[model samples]
Target: MEVYVELTYCMNGILFIMTYEMISLLLNINWSFLKILFLSFLSNISIVLIYIDYLPYISFLYWIVLFLFIFKKQFFLYFPVFLIVYFSILFFINTLIKESFIYNGILITPINYKDIVIVVMTCVFLIIETIYLIYAKRKIKPKDDLYDVTLIFNNKIYHLSGFLDSGNHANYLGYPLIFIKKSKIDTYQQLDTLIIDGLKKRKIDIILVDQVLVNKQSLRNVYIGVLDELDYDCLLNKELMGGII
Candidate 1:
């Protein structure tokens, strides 16, 4: 039985990319997906060449050079940790599936087994990475201090979590404003609107909400505009921070 070289290359390439992706996520580093894909494809060339030429020593040299060139020093230091975690998971799964190809009292490996391992390992890494990222963010904010905001609109009240930000110093004709995601309150009929063109002339719509309350302090005639994105449900402007805090 011969190995499927093409399948091996594809599996190795995917695994290489996933390993770095998890590493980047854990470190909270920003890496473009395209760069990761290129690094993965480039690193696996040495492995594919070894499978073809049967020259492990020379192939190892090329692999190391490409790996170090593409990845930073942090990756070099932490990659072994990734390998340990990946192999440990693969071993644990292998125990349950017991999918082994054996010939003459020796355990052989099927090409499909490699594929299954890659899929399983990638999933395990992603789950751990997501949980870690969530924890990393929450660790920075105190749970008890987070403010509860109530939006009164159309005789209907919507409750949301909010944070007072000093950086939100914008105002509309001296009237204080709050920031919320457009998707959260887009249903309400906006009383007024403003369009601002940035350096790239990207037009942004800013809508005004009639009323909002922070923890019991009422903010009447406040503007509620759309943010590019937000981590919280709402952000209270600095003008309202004095009343809320």
Candidate 2:
């Protein structure tokens, strides 16, 4: 009985660590393997709640605390999303393993081939996660159209991922216009406004930043159009690269 419980704990720890790492990569967050391992270890400790019959509630609360610690300001936004996806993948893998054992006529007992099932389940989970991560990375960020951008405004330096958009030819008084995500920048006094003709005619605020760096090339006095509907962090103007590429 002790051996069975120990094996379950260790296998669960491995799964937790892998899941966190996979989610981090998918979200474009840089989390070290060692840090994830440590957090997973702590999370696995909640398994002890099983002895007191408080396993489910305590385990859920413990994981919520950990997620809050890791995600900080984005806790509320990311926790529910992560929880749903994580459990869905977990349920799929669990069902797969159970069906495989039943089809093979392998009886799962605490001291029987349960260990083998757990190990095989973890391996299968890793394989599925690897494939999904690779596919998501390519689809979410295509290297050809993305650029590394640095914005210096209000004496603060901000690094962002920019998408090169050829259609964004809007300019203001000769200076090319660059569209940025409204949430990325703090609230600033709106200097002026520009009406953009897209699917709908919408007026966006125009603000001037001190300097903008697109793919390491610096451009000064560029007009910035803040859009609430921007998908990427920044949208690079094709004309902005005319003089400096």
Candidate 3:
């Protein structure tokens, strides 16, 4: 709506000039502006090829909103990284699949402004999706009743509400915090090796390991792993919403 609006033209006598809307779109970009522009152009072409024939009149703003919400926080940081890694991986995979055992190549394609918008939008969408996934993982409040013999898995330590019993006492006369479960540990070798390695330089020799969640449940026949920590200092404290101290 301003007088400073401008335009550009393509080779076919049509005004293929940059518009005010496009300029406004680019205004918010900071450091990775040029790279963003290039990637955006590429994605627009892709969207056209995929949806142009069927969904004839799709608005650019719709894609923008979708991408912005999904990847609001990580858009700038991840977009360039995604572009670089995606192309590199794609090229390597394509070369591996081809008859030629070796392929060293370059990707050179013309940029269309529309493509830039789509790529940026899609990048934002993926970023938001990633955030949502992480949020979900964090939101999972682990239940105490579901576990027995919690473990200090290297850096992260977990607490388990373990059941103590006999038949499951498989410790070879060591300081392993043993527990009883009705199931078996799958790939015991790998788990043992991991626990052993975690305890090699620590204050403990072995661990109190076994399994948890007996049959007729979701976690059936699960072989639990644990290790002894010397300076194993991880604690969780909780307080009421409005309580002090």
- Local distance difference test scores for all models: 0.60, 0.70, 0.31
Model 2, 137-192: lDDT tens digits are 56766578888899988888889989888898878888788989998988777789
Across 43-86, the per-residue lDDT of candidate 1 in tens digits comes to 66655455344543655466556645654454465556555543
User: What is the alpha-carbon lDDT of model 1 when measured against the actual structure?
Assistant: 0.60
Q: Residue 15: error of model 3 in Å?
A: 34
**Candidate 1 — worst ten consecutive residues by lDDT sum?**
100-109
lDDT of model 1 at position 117: 72
TM-score of each: 0.48, 0.49, 0.25
The residue-by-residue lDDT of candidate 3 on 1-245, one tens digit each, is 11110111111001001111122233432223344434344333333322344543342333344445545655564444444444453354334333212111212222345533533554465456445444554464334423233343333434544432222333333422343221222222323433232312322222333322222122212333333331112111111101211
Best candidate (score: lDDT): 2
Model 3, position 78: C-alpha lDDT score: 42
49: Cα error in model 1, Å: 16
Number of backbone collisions per candidate: 0, 0, 15
lDDT of 2 at 241: 74
